[model samples]
Target: MQTAADREAKLQRHRLRMTLLSVANTSLQSVIIGLYAWAGEVGWSVAWRFFLVGAGSSAMFALIIWRGLNLRLKDPGLLLPQIALSVLIQLLFLVLAPKLWVLFLVAVLVTYNFAMMSFSARQFTLAWLLVGAASALALFAARGRFGHFGTSGVSIAILWLFFFLCIRQLTAIGTQFSSLRTQLSEKNKQLSASLERIQELASHDDLTGALNRRSFMQLLADERARAQRAGQPFCIALLDIDHFKTVNDRFGHLIGDAVLKEFCAVAAASIRVTDRFARYGGEEFMLLLAPSTSSDVARVATERVRQALEAHDWDRIAPGLRVTLSAGVSQLAPDESVEQLVRRADEALYAAKDAGRNRTVVA
Candidate 1:
């Protein structure tokens, strides 16, 4: 699970990267402005002013987001403010360097395009209206100074350079979107895997990988309902590892847990796939065998499990380790409740223990 702090930190890192990209964009524009100034098309002071204002605004936003100061805002990205400021700056430059109005106009469009990545449709519409109104006002105020495009070769070359930069910015945006898509896919897969693990933990024993008692009972009830409707027969067996406490005391709980796990594996392999196996409690297990009509069939199934465990190579686990199981098998009586059936099996299990530790008894 992602903690609040982790989510916040991730957001901060994303915002910081966006800020850096904004700064890089501003730097590119500043370079173009510097080039124009060097060619004597604009004053050096104008280039310096634009560079300082653009870079400083980006740095200010970065600091605010990084310091956790934007959390109170509904739109933590401050998309509107950034777009409004960028448009206003472009208009200012359009008025100051009217001969390069095309350059500044393109820059304003670039700003809107960048905003498209973060803005919702409604937000984008609102940003469009805001920029439209602000541009109208700024253009009106500088009506005489705003519309100049030279027919010189140098001007055409600069226009081509500006188009090339715009293409680069668009490509970068496409790459960012591609990266986000891949990340979303990976996160979705991780979420699915986490949900599967949660379901497994809820339904199965952590150590033996068999159904837990509660889940087993639920399945048993459902099975009983279906069986009663279809007039089918089924049997249940309660199994206990003989001398489990002694094994734990001599070899330690870890070894005891391993033995339990191995026993379940052997029992599962010995039983039919249609049967359901569960860990009833500590060192005790149960099996629900389906389509079984006779006590002889139930006893044979239980005996198979007992024989498999007894024949297992316990020497690989420990030099002197030996393991055995005793089981109690019970068939469903006519109209019998689940509780009664389980109780009868419990009694038979105790009887098996009382008689000899490594055998099966039927009820």
Candidate 2:
């Protein structure tokens, strides 16, 4: 649902926040060093050297932030340059710390920042391993300056172990959340499909596979409304199978059912796909045609159904078996009610049956 503009705006806001954080962190470090220099706690030369390093690092980050401002033009996160810059920043911190043992804290901070990025677990693990190894090598190189391996050495090793455990725990939790999300998505899809199938069953007749009377009437109402608005003509036809009761009496209801289904299938093929067909009741049905007038177009559609039914191989149901339909087509008059139209069509159907069987009458 999110538009491209919305996503771009979100990325811009995130990049802005990252830029501000970088500025704030850099400024705080510079201020702290400046305070030490001003108070003479550290010599002005040493303080200035640290201040220069922080300022230079801040400038480098600012350059990256400048690139980030154009994030929409390119990727905004976890570029190789960004990763290298983060590593260089942590190395700067390691070099500036008074005690070599403090490298463990620097490693923890760097790992946390990397974990917050878009890296996969594999990438994070590989990067973290490299960082931890570098920290250990740096400590080993500085061991002579600090004399023997003491409590500080033990504390550094313990912190590294704790960091490793944290990473494993976080990875496990991430995997579980991913699995739960997939299951939830599949359940939502299945529920949606089930609801659709239920609706289809509710809307259609089981025997004829046509719209049920209720759904058909609803569709007719909609078509009527549309025709009224568009000043277009629409019509309905009521059809009945001739002597359907006799077929049931002579051949049993099973053969009668087969004849009804076959008649519907033939009529469906004869009508336009845009037309609506429905089983109105036993041996009765309705047809709705839109953008068409009653006498000519509607009559043609009914005639097609009548001809199709008469031509079909009804003898398959039983020897010498034959079936026919009587239909009445009525066009909508201006501002006519649905009941009035149906009643008129029903009257016409009765007239068709009275005059003769197997025929269509238009009203």
TM-scores for the candidates: 0.78, 0.57
Residue pairs with backbone atoms closer than 3 Å in model 2 (clashes): none
Write the residue-wise lDDT of candidate 2 on 1-363 in tens digits: 899989877766665565444444445444544444454433465445645665465556556656665564455653444555545555554445433334334434543563544667787788778767776765565555442123454444544554554455456447746866897899899999999889988998888788899999898888888888988889999999999999999999999989888888898999987788999999999999876565688999889999989998877779889999999889988999888889999999998999897999987
Per-residue lDDT tens digits for candidate 1, residues 13-55, read 8877887777788888888888777766788988889889987
Off by over 4 Å in 2: 1-161
Candidate 2: count of backbone clashes, pairs at least 3 residues apart or interchain: 0
Worst 10 residues of 2 by lDDT: 98-107
Which ranges in model 1 have alpha carbons more than 4 Å from their true place?
A: 1-17, 33-49, 59-80, 95-102, 116-128, 136-153, 291-296, 333-335
What do the candidate models score in CA lDDT, each in turn? 0.86, 0.71
